[model samples]
Target: MTPTQIAALIVAGAFVLLVVLLAIPLVKLGRTLDEATVAIRKAHENTDPIFTGANSTLTHVNTQLERVDGITANAKTVSGNVSALSSLFTATLGGPLVKTAAFSYGVSKALRARRKRKEEPWGKHSRRKGGRK
Candidate 1:
């Protein structure tokens, strides 16, 4: 064979070896992409039920919140009513009750002072002198 032909044959063999080496990695990359696609699909399938459950839980929580809102409204109304009743009681009876308490305290103090004066001995002089009056 000629030297030129032999050189061309060697070049072709090297080109084939290079293509074979490149193709192996390309095939492995394609397989890895396929696995990634499958994993994504499985994750999507798994998350659907989780999302549904979350939606249901949110719905129940909202329902409970609405009930709490109703209870809060009732409590607010009761508080307002109690405040009005307290104001009414204060307006009606607070002044009279204070006056009565003051009068009773004054009467009790006067009675105690009178009783103390009477208890002092008739034969003994009062705080002014220790000798008999």
Candidate 2:
């Protein structure tokens, strides 16, 4: 072959070798992209139900919390009512009961002192400021 023809053939052969080298990596890249797509699809399928279940669980928890709030409100109302009842009872009977107790105690003390004086006419006692000696 002529020298020019041989040089042309060598250049063509170099181009073919380069193309083959580049084609190998391109093919591997395509396979890697396909694997990544499959993995993403699998993850999407697995997480769909998980998200749905989480939404339902949150809804149920919210409903329970609402019930708890209602119970707390009822408890507060009952507590207020009991406090009002206690105040009413104290207002209606507290003063009279205290005064009656004080009166009874005074009467009993006077009777006991008179009896003691009769029994011990000459006994020494601590005299009050202006009472009979």
Candidate 3:
């Protein structure tokens, strides 16, 4: 009946209307959130097998890399051994082999020179006979 009481009632009614209007959208938002959560869970479930397969492939690749690393390590060791053996063989055999080769070459050259000297006398006799004619 009073003007102040009427204003208070109008304000309360307006607040109630605002709450009712806001509740509809809030309910819709909650449902949408629930649907999104379900869809995300399903997506994760569907991709689980793919993720597992990728993990298995990665594990296999790691295993293969380990084998490759082992092979490389063995190859490196073999290379070192071969280099050392070559050095040892060179040190043991290189000097005597080089000396023997030099001696054999010198003897062959001396024999060839002796043969050439023996033929020189016949070559001079033939040249002198030809000049007389």
Candidate 4:
């Protein structure tokens, strides 16, 4: 054969050998991918019940929170009502009671002063003239 033809034949043989070497690892990768897919499917199947239970639990928790929110709203309303009642009582009762107490104290003081004046033994001018003339 000529040198150019021999070189071409060698190149083709090398290309075929490279293809054969690469195919072995490609087949192995495909098989590993298949196994991983099956394992993922099995895991999903096994955990379905757990996912269902979690969903049910989340629903229950949401319901309880809604109930708590309703209770809190009621408590807020009650607190507001109590505050209004306290304000009303202070307005209607507290003002008059304080005025009555002040009046009673003033009357008592006046009576005490009157009694002291009556027990004195001199008139106002005599006392002012230092008990002489």
lDDT (Cα atoms) of all candidates against the true structure: 0.91, 0.92, 0.91, 0.90
Q: All candidates' TM-scores?
A: 0.80, 0.64, 0.63, 0.63
Which one wins by lDDT: 2 or 4? 2
- Per-residue lDDT tens digits of candidate 3, residues 43-70? 9999989999999999999999999999
Candidate 4: lDDT of 78?
Answer: 100
User: Candidate 4's residue-wise lDDT over 6-31, tens digit each?
Assistant: 99999999999999999999999999
Q: Highest TM-score, which number?
A: 1
Which scores greater on lDDT, model 1 or model 4?
1
Q: In candidate 1, what are the lDDT values of residues 1-133, reduced to their tens digit?
A: 8999999999999999999999999999999999999999999999999999999999999999999999999999999999999999999999899899999999999997777767874434355455444
Please, what are the lDDT tens digits per residue for candidate 2 over residues 22-131?
Answer: 99999999999999999999999999899999999999999999999999999999999999998988899888888999999999999999889777666565354455
What is the lDDT, from 0 to 100, of the residue 46 in candidate 3?
Answer: 90
Taking every candidate in turn, the Cα RMSD to the unseen true structure, in Å, is 3.1, 4.9, 5.7, 5.4
Q: List the residue pairs that clash in candidate 4.
A: none
Give the poorly placed runs of model 1, Cα more than 4 Å off: 1-3, 120-132
Model 3 clash tally, residue pairs: 0
